[model samples]
Target: MEYSFRIQLVAIVSLMLVFPNTQGWGEDGHTIVCSIAQARLSNTAAEKVKELLPPGNDLASMCSWADHVKFYLPWSSALHYIDTPDNLCTYQYERDCKDQNGEKGRCVAGAINNYTTQLLNHGTDNSYNLTQALMFLAHFMGDIHQPLHVGFTSDRGGNSINVHWYTRKQNLHHCWDANIIETAEERFYDSNIDEFIDAIQQNITKTWSSQVEGWETCNSNETTCPDIYASEDIKAACQWAYKGVSDGSVLEDDYFLSRLPIVNLRLAQGGVRLAATLNRIFG
Candidate 1:
């Protein structure tokens, strides 16, 4: 509307074109996470979510809304991931939660906290946009679980490291972001995203049943524990994502088969934790 706002929007759109690798998990990954979460939500939280979402849209359908709006909301770009110190394989909110400009609380973990805090105002005298808050909280929960989202600062979380995912050439970040999930969907699920999600859901109920509660619990009555999730992410980044792969490495069957389980686990954790956090918030 305003002339200055229009100029700012154009500038941010330019940045989006220049830095396309800042995204979190791909569309299917996000949808899988949100679908799991929405199914697990308490009645109160689910109804609140329904009220907040746009008409005819569910949480899973809007899970990627945060990613889509980055062009106009430039400040949100940095909030999609954290850049920890190179070779550390550890994440500390104070040290690693800043943006490239070194602004604290600008990373994915902080984004979750900030949005969760905003959503806590639901059913009361609310000021912040709870719809955006819900979408961001749901989205960042998935991002924090993405191992590479809390990856080394030197490589921009593997975005700069070129690699070949099987045959096609792409970056390490893109592999973790979309390629791996897409490949898994195509090869294993007949390219059906819903089938991929159903398989993960089945694992959550049976294979991972005992561990789900532990993943959902937070110490000291916290609504969310992103610090714990971020810590796990960096460790996974070291142990699984960047372990044997070098720049220009070819990620083939061995890499994909081994890493798909970790991806599945992270998606499950992201979904379970998101539902747990929202339940705590809206309960």
Candidate 2:
């Protein structure tokens, strides 16, 4: 019995070693998206958001609230992502977004649709519902853009792929979500999240102004477009994010420097598109 216990304990510790981290692109990434959206929101949209949030809490503060509650609300966990089939390597709504139970159109993209409708039409239904929609939208918007969140089923969105960031061991998913972005901030932005995001917003506004319409138009007021949008992420993850990653691979400066643009571009797109959604719903 003692030997069996030791074996179980070792397995638990080994799993924990690799899985130790928060879900989704770390809090900083989500907050950066929300904050940029807040900055870009029209006066009316900003006012509406301020009215929805709890007193003293802003959009950025509750950006990760969905992840926090997914423990108890297990039904919503799969709403964070849609897994493209391993061989498929693409996000087809009819193919991928049947939820974990195979229920059609109930993935993160679906969640965005439902929550957006709720906020747009029934935002005043009650405080609880209003808050739920706002939190879901804020979090899901960021999730759909993380690239890995729209990643593969075979490896559990890169979670199953063991990797090392330089010398520290971690999985590909967490590395993209947390480590890479964290390291990017430290190296390029002096670890200043605000300054980095602000500069990203400015650069996006100046350099990608025309592209905003293309991206924002990719998502309509309806939910049908989120699938199309998520496909963009899945394709990106396949061609860019998992490019060189392999079992026991050590990723260093080249990987980080090359992928920072993707991280920044996705962040920029998320913020701008979020602002567009809010403006339409509240305008």
Q: What lDDT does each candidate get?
A: 0.88, 0.80
Model 1 — TM-score against the truth?
0.92
Evaluate model 2: give its TM-score.
0.88
What tens digits encode model 1's per-residue C-alpha lDDT throughout 156-212? 989999999988999998899898899999999899999998899999999999999
Error of 2 at 111 (Å): 0.6
Which number leads on lDDT? 1
Candidate 1 residue-wise lDDT at 35: 97
**TM-score for each prediction?**
0.92, 0.88
Off by over 4 Å in 1: 1-22
Candidate 2: list runs displaced more than 4 Å.
1-21, 123-128, 218-224
